[model samples]
Target chain A: MASALARTTYNVFFRRSSNYLVGIFAGAFAFEIAFDSAADRLWDMANKGRQWKDIRSKYIQAADSEPADDEE
Target chain B: MFTRAAYTTATRAAFRAPTFAQARNASTQAANGAFGADRKAAAAWFAKAAAGSAILGYGISNYVVTDDRLAPVTKAVAESMTALQKKAAEYGIEMPFTVAHAFSTADHGLHPPHYPWDHFKPWKTYDHASIRRGFQVYKEVCSACHSMEYIHYRNLVGVSHTESEAKELAAEYEYEDGPNDKGEMFMRPGKLTDPMPSPYPNEEAARAANGGAYPPDLSCIARARHGEEDYIFALLLGYCDPPAGVNVREGLHYNPYFPGGAIAMARAIYDEVVEYEDGTPNNASQLAKDVSTFLSWASYPEHDERKKMGLKTLAISAMLLGLSVWWKRFKWSYIKTRKIVYKPGKFDEV
Candidate 1:
């Protein structure tokens, strides 16, 4: 269903009367990627890597524990 | 009308007895044999029996262990629980469950209220004086039982203490050095590069010293524990006598802040516990607050750095978003605002 919709959207963009629609799609796609990365960077800057369970693993209790059965 | 009646009669005759209503029911029962009335009634009876057995099992267990008249154990437990509940009332709250209570009786992950911090924010930094005083509090009080394994002497160079001060602090402890030519290990004075050493040599020794409860390391514990710094501060000061009814174990102490309303750690601080060189008041609360801040820094030396970078990133992202919007409007306006008009018969000439 989604692929069919995308095909229709691409067809509309490449058509002569709505040719500028292609530029808009390309620009929107690029902007979305850039915006996502910038948001990720902001989160990283504020959170300081403390919100992860792995960070808790650095504590003494976690260090003293035995490895899980599946883990090497 | 005659044809309809004939059809009904024909349908009824194909099933059991030729009576209309009985035959209709018989036909339905034959059609839905697997899911018929008898089968449904049997399933209902089985479900009812299962529920009855579960209720009976719970009641029997409760009678045997809790309210059992076989021994006076039930009375003692109830009396103790009632006393604990009353003691909890002194704090204007009561614990809903006890340590002896089954896990199924209570929900997990009971968090204290999230008290906000004035300094520990994404846009703010630690109060440096608090951090410094907190370190002193640790050295004087909490350091007796707790260890900060993740903190190193060098980690305090810029955040809490100067390089010379940190070095002197490091020199106070002895760390084991590697085997020399004789292949035997020896003790050496601690260096700035070394991590803070554990108080007891091993886990078993630490547990033995503290009645089978090893004191947890304080390193990064401000970040590690839920409720964060505020919870720690409250816990340090929340210790009190166990009112009338609660029975604390021989070694345990009453601390409402602990999950079970009892903790192995006794109250470690009193009024004027540690004298501050900077002449800050040496009250119990002040020490607790300062020590909590210091532990925060130990757990998160990168806090200030992260806050600074966060502010810069927020400003840059705002500018980028604004520019992107402006550029988007600039590029799309021609197509968006353009007006094309046509008269009904005038287009042919054009």
Candidate 2:
């Protein structure tokens, strides 16, 4: 069973060296995307109430209710 | 005939085939044709073998990296790294880490506790109402000793007071003006342009009045100190009896929050020290909180605008991040998914 699995793996990924190179490049690209998104999510969770997203609604409501001032 | 015979003999000697003995002797000489008769073919074969080995190495590496058998190992490593990062964030361990200064038991004072100020969060702005009350506190209490030399009466407009109100507040104080026609200085009512007036003319006068301990300017005190607003709030109410075996001088008061467990400025804020115009409680803690917030605003006048800009920046960055991620994937999809198949005889025919 191990020999058969190895033969299949070689045929799929290593028969041509270009196939292996392409697979590595694709895997790295996918990993980068996954890691970036996961890190972003973790950061958002950790700083839940401190971020602007958490208070944006309240800020908008306050702004809408109050008369606009001339001051920048 | 004699010259021709000598020339022929010399040519024969120079071009003669090696004898058996000479060939054996020349065996140790370097070979001239190390690459053999077809050097190009030998080099091409070596290049092909090197390329094949390199491809084999890349294939082995790719297989090892993507192996499902090592998933748990990779997962554990990633988890541990993230946990360490989380711990660092929790402890506020900034880069170029240094140990916190240790206080000696002989004279070290108490460390102030962190207060949850309304504006403590990155997205939060100063409580304007509290700032207005803080201004009242400063005007009534701290201004007697400390000068806000960097603050002008006009700065109050649209922040804590209206234009007319700021003008009126400025008019309450008197400032010395330039020489008159008689070359004598004259006094004029303060204007919007004038800085907040100091209680004393100079540092020496201030020191003489306050028993050699001149009150520092409060304009930048919030930022100058280690604890900022938290230290100010604690110091205002930190006064207490000295612990056992400690001696406070005649002029100095014992405040555990102040460094060395003693401060020249005595307990300034007390219950009902100043009445608030908005009918907020006149307790000592509330007074301390308001004044600390005011001082924080004094130190960072751009606090609200900075937070607002931060929110805008974060929002824009989030949008750009999403768009760039999508754009990158879209651009790479065709190259990543396309398959190339070879027809053996077609290239030869071409």
Candidate 3:
């Protein structure tokens, strides 16, 4: 049963028709190229591998500091 | 009878083959020759194979792709026209193709405040508690002028509010409905599915409320700017008195993050602006962080789900490619070292 299934897949992919080979290559390549870069866009949201509050404390004027005092 | 006859003939022929180890007559050899029949068979087989492949390719294209495949990739498919345009441009002949943006902000020499979010390193997601607090800030402050027109009460179910809480929250607003049986429009209680109502009726009203400048919608603010969520946090905290050396304009606020260091909208966030229900800090910086994270989630709600799906897709494809390679090698190995032999052919004297 396993051998028969493998043979069917093999024929569909590599031997049955040249069109199947072309479609497989196009589909695989499109998904690889498009999805890889599209997924990377989401990763841009990462901010120095820390939460927003941690990053905020670094620059935000602390409440304890006087209004006139300048933070470098 | 025919089978017996043929068997008898084959036997008689075998018996006569080596009577004296003499050469057979040319006519007899020609009668048994296979070269013409083999050539005819090869041509017929290829004709059928070609027709089959053509039909299969046509059928496959119906599902895989219908339009021209090159349309997506070709920047300019008319290679001749692009070559001509380049040549003409090089010769100082300008065309009307390139248009510049109106009111491009000039550099003010004020450097941008430093913040993280420059790289694709590590990972990020909105803090749910922070997002809830941010929603409070928006409801109490920003909602007076700016609006998040795209978001719906239903969207808050898992991210910020419980399902029943979201339904109750949505019920507070009165949304306008279609014409009734009397041909008059009527007001209806807002549903969980209803979009957040704009603070102002129109753009003109929104602009009038905030001087001449219209407060842009915050629905996609995180994505609209290149800086993403960090820029919004910085902008809220950026407001300050103008530098003494520069002339301060009337009715404009000072923020170095603003392109010209002048902004129409007054500073909105302040320390202890909103009383947090969760007993979290209510400082300006804390509020800014929470609000920015909320806006980020609003811009990209399904980011976590998307990333999970992308990881799964990539892993599955990688496994498929590996399996396909192994299968190809396994099947082709049988034919790799195969050889064939044939008997030497007789040639008639030229």
Q: Which numbered prediction scores highest in DockQ against the true structure?
A: 3
TM-score of 3: 0.54
lDDT (C-alpha) at residue B201 in model 3: 94
Candidate 1: how large is its RMSD?
22.6
* List of chain A TM-scores, every candidate: 0.47, 0.63, 0.40
Q: Where in model 1 is the C-alpha error above 4 Å? A: A1-72, B1-116, B344-350
The regions of model 2 sitting more than 4 angstroms off are A1-72, B1-102, B105-108, B346-350
CAPRI-style docking class of model 1 based on DockQ? incorrect
Candidates in order have lDDT scores of 0.71, 0.76, 0.69
Per-residue lDDT tens digits of candidate 3, residues B173-213?
99998799999999999898898879999999988877788
- Cα-based lDDT at residue B324, candidate 1: 86
lDDT comparison, 1 vs 3, better candidate: 1
The true-versus-predicted C-alpha distance at residue B190 of model 1, in Å, is 0.9
Please give the distance, in angstroms, between residue B101's alpha carbon in candidate 3 and its true position after superposition: 13
Q: Write the per-residue lDDT of candidate 2 for residues A1-72, one digit (tens) a residue.
A: 147987888887888889899988998899767766765665556456543344333323333443233122
Candidate 3 per-residue lDDT over residues A1-72, each given as its tens digit: 147987786676767678677978898999878766766554434433333333333333344344222211
lDDT per residue (tens digit) for residues B111-200 in model 1: 455556656555556776677778889988888889888788877765555555677889999898989899999999999899877778
